[model samples]
Target chain A: MTVQLDFLKNVLYFSGLDLAEIESIDKLVFEKSAERGEMVLLEGESATDLYFVASGAVKVFKTSAEGKEQILSIVRPGESFNDVSIFDGGPNPASARAMGPVLLYGIKKNDIEAILRNHPRVVLNVINVLASRVRHLVSLVEDLSFKHVIGRVAKILFEQVGGGQMGRGPRLTQQEMAAMAGTAREVVGRSLKALEEEGAIKVDRNRIVITDKEALKRVMEVSS
Target chain B: MAEMPGIDREKCDGCGLCVIVCHCGALTMVDKSINIIETVECDWCTDCEAVCATGAISCPFEISIE
Candidate 1:
């Protein structure tokens, strides 16, 4: 119970809550474990809970009629997903799949609703989080429509490096990079090769090293 | 449909990303190649597939949750 309280404190929606409030919430949440590639929630299913990541990651994605997957967001530790579904009292907007062996803590919609009724401050924090999600979606659409394939690839690389917070990041497969970049895998491969040749990045073993930040930035925001 | 996860030998570049993320300890690196140590007990966390930069590991099945 104490451990759960610590984890809940890190969540953006509940971060500002006092110790007593967090303790109250700790009782409402339940634990779930999902293996990698397992679908945790299905699109169009009735939403029941909001999930927060404790460890590992989750990918919120949508599938077209033809079954092509477009990942909308990757929820990392200290973050949550399915907020829109739970709050709006609607079907899941997208399916959630575990990116790895993920441990999650979820609060039922009814439990969270009760908390929201009592805590107006939490509603404000939730609104801020939703607004940020909207901004991220807007940027995603803009990237898909306006950016060239190379630019998109560069953008993905930039983000993988903790948005310039880290000089290196896990080397992603071309297929994974293409999914994030919204381009063909071949295009992503070509882009990586180009970046490598230009000394903008170096793929050493299992990690990607940002060799030149300025060069990478230039490619990420390509005007053409 | 292939419900079981399988490693594509042609695609597996032996980067061992699969082994690193397998919380189940089912995958191991041998001779610079990935080998499934426990074929049946895989917790199916698909991290092996997600982390494989070469598209080598894949679980061609989706768990239906209702």
Candidate 2:
């Protein structure tokens, strides 16, 4: 149908395909939905399919035996996950959980392999995405190793602001910020308090306003 | 048994940042030094190792079977 083709056209991997190829690929795709907080994939599960996020968000994370969680990345709409696993036919490296109600498009490994064979350029795209993920992981490792808590918090805030001119950023809970910073909630609270004391930021009921962007950058620099 | 993370006492500044980052509660500070309290609870997520400011926590070397 035209609706399905339109959706396929928006996906980066299928963007190069013509109408006929899109339609053929669409036939091989299936839709899946998950409620908020639902587990979409489990770490160590066999990778049989690659998934595209049609709507909503999903958090990719690894869990400790004690039920502690370390989030790897968050997949937003139009992005995809499990490409590497599908290519290697290996188990999922991490688990994915729906942050909210989510809709996804899934393609089986065999179908994706066939498509890749026809369009080698798709391999380049996959590699590009994987490379970016590696870069992100490397930065995360660096942040965890070298950056202090305040520096990590500032970096995360700047990232959330999209590195644009500072203003009222997205509303996020303390717990959410803690998870992203790879620290405890208390640590985030203390850091935010310190930033607030320095007139660098303002914390107002689930939202943070960056009052002085330069001051925040100074905090990161001084710590680094 | 899985290899546990080893702490380099010489490098450890005892900042307790690793203790705060260790979600599994496997790490603790005693006498201004980091110690693995319960090895069984450690998931080797490398969270503590990643957050150590002094690179005090080193994960066990992993051998690739591939």
lDDT of 2 at B43: 66
Query: Candidate 2 has which clashing residue pairs, if any?
Result: none
Tell me how many residue pairs clash in candidate 2.
0
Candidate 1 lDDT tens digits, A1-224: 57788999888898689988988889899999998879999999998999998877787888779675666876777788999989889999999998767889999999999989877778998998999999988876665566587777777777776777765466455567767877654445456667777778775423456778788888876734
Return the TM-score for each candidate structure: 0.57, 0.54
Off by over 4 Å in 1: A148-224, B1-66
lDDT of 2 by residue, A1-224 (tens): 67657887878787667787788788889999997678999999987989998876677888778675666776766789887688777899999987656789999999998988877867777777888888877866665456587777877776667664533356444546667877654455557767778887775423466767788889988876
Worst 10 residues of 1 chain A by lDDT: A183-192
**Candidate 1 lDDT (Cα, whole model)?**
0.74
State the TM-score of the second chain for every model: 0.76, 0.84
Which lDDT value does model 1 have at A219?
82
